[model samples]
Target: MAGPLASLKVLDFSTLLPGPYATMLLADMGAEVLRVEAPDRMDLTRVMPPHDGGVSTAHGYLNRGKSAISLNLKDEGSADRIKALVAEFDVVVEQFRPGVMDRLGIGYEALKAVNPGLIYCSITGYGQTGPYKNRAGHDINYLSLAGVSSHCGRADSGPPPMGIQIADVAGGSHHAVMGILAAVIHRQQSGEGQYVDVSMTDAAFALNAMSGAACLAGGQEQKPESSLLNGGSFYDYYQTSDGRWLSVGSLEPQFSSRLCDTLGLEKMKSFALSQNPEHQVALKKALKDAIATRTLAEWQAVFSETDACVEPVLTIAEAAEHPQLKARDMVILVDRGDGSQQRQIGFPIKFEKTSCRAEWIGKNLGADNKKYF
Candidate 1:
């Protein structure tokens, strides 16, 4: 059976996490995604460590279910080939500096000429037009510039690096996918396509809604660990006696009361979500002291029957085998074509009639050149 996006065709000229991830999602939903890479300028992710079947694990995961064709965009022949492909592909996603695609002779305007209904998406560090448009940056730089890091760290600790690439995935990849899908719907109605200019910094800044609201609407600058969602309240993480951690999110009055009751801290009920620093400190200390008396597993068992949002922090391996994730089939086995199978995180989008699939892992570079070119 065909998936939801089976009719769509995408030419993915982006590399690394953001664009690749978006295209991967599309491919999972049955889009015909053709990954275009330079013959001599392969994506850096191809060389990243933790290789499986001589392919980078990250690449295998991101480019799964997609075909690949190598083309040197710097060459005139490649330019002509891309123009021919532009007319066939419904969507074109690229990640380059502002003028790089234009200089390559495959900008949105040029491609739109070939295929007027082409959904062209550009993902960059900054936008196509800005003082920092041409600046080079990664996920961390974008998050910092967007003021997201200002409210992410502990009160006394300097801004620590995030465990994941929040800006790259959320700001660039997810936003680009949203824009492309919206444009797809608009094209269906108006028979016209538009350019989606996605800036990582812009997307990251937009995701700072909580802090932005405080600053813009309330004229308040949020400090790290001083906001309601940050660590100003009883909602935080606590270390257990077994040296593992558990997240606590008993924010609502009912949940807070339940947590206090479970921990035998009835006196701390009034300070559940208090903004006073003294109250916050006292409540946090009391909760931490109570939590430290038990192991992570013991606390998990204790909270298993409750509505309080408390859960043990699991590592990546543990999460893969978690009951909830396992029941949902979030981890799937892929054939490496060498008499061996590899486990990978499965597609997330679930549909009743047209479920997504992971048909295969990423192919070798230019593996589909003969078929496409």
Candidate 2:
């Protein structure tokens, strides 16, 4: 059967991770996405390292299943062409600063004039209107401004560096998809397309739902190691004898009791999440000492049959080969049309009937120029 968004059309003018990722998700769900590039400039990801068949691996993954066309928005003729195309497409996604598109004559109002039902989405660092609207930023800057990084570190050594681009993927890409879908639904009802102004910083700030609420609502600011979920208690990672790590999440009373018994620390059961600083340090040290007595694999075997919620941390390679993720089809093989295949992370959302697949990798620049022209 056709995917849920098989009938929708997306005109993607954004490049790089955030907007491209959002459009890729739509394309995976069966939307007809036409990625528009500049004839003079190209997405930097096209040259990003880790190549397959001489093409950037990251670009191949992000732009898969989407068509490409190049147009010079600087030219009047090209602007006219885009204006004409805007009337034919269902949505337009751009990642320029506030007034850049307006100067190019293809802003939301200009497109709305041609197709009033056009869903125009603008993804930016800050927003279209604000004191820092034109400010430059990346994942780290946004995460810091949003107060997310302050609560994500070890109490003694300060915050650890983030491995992933949380602000780019979670703040921008995911939220862009959400806003676009919401606008799509709203358009279906009102028959009037609207503008979606997505600010990465705003989205990052909104992600502070739990800790921020504690401070704002209950007057409880989250300290470095005082928050229960942030490492104030026994719910933390411990290094084992073999240098590997084990995560422990024995938060509840019963689970804590079982964990204490399993670790031969019956005294710790009563102090699972004690708020007293001295008691907390003593309990943590005791648990650490006990855990350090065994290798990570040995501890894994000991708690494998229990409900202690303790598990060994695996490297990326081990994670990819994990039986549980393999059983769930979380990793899949994508054929490259040659004798070889590329392994890619699979789409998470599953449907009972509709099919979701990455039909192809990123196309050559302007591969579909003739069709558009």
Per-residue lDDT for 98-177 in model 2, tens only? 99999999999999999999999999989899899998888899888888888888878887778888888899999999
Error of 2 at 90 (Å): 1.1
Residue 264 lDDT (model 2): 92
Summed backbone clashes in each candidate are 0, 0
For candidate 1, what is the TM-score? Answer: 0.97
Instruction: Estimate every model's Cα lDDT from 0 to 1.
Output: 0.91, 0.88
Residue-level lDDT of model 1, residues 1-373, one tens digit each, is: 8889999999999998999998999999999999999999879889899998788999888998899999889987777899998899999999988988999999999999999999999999998997999899999999999999988888798688989899899889899999999999999999999999999999999999978988999999998887778877778899999999999998888999999999999988999867788998899999999999999999989999998888889999999999999999999987775767889998776799998987888888999999988
Query: What is the C-alpha local distance difference test score of candidate 2?
Result: 0.88
TM-score of 2: 0.95
Clashing pairs in 2: none
Clashing residue pairs for model 1: none
- Candidate maximizing lDDT: 1
**Which candidate leads in TM-score?**
1
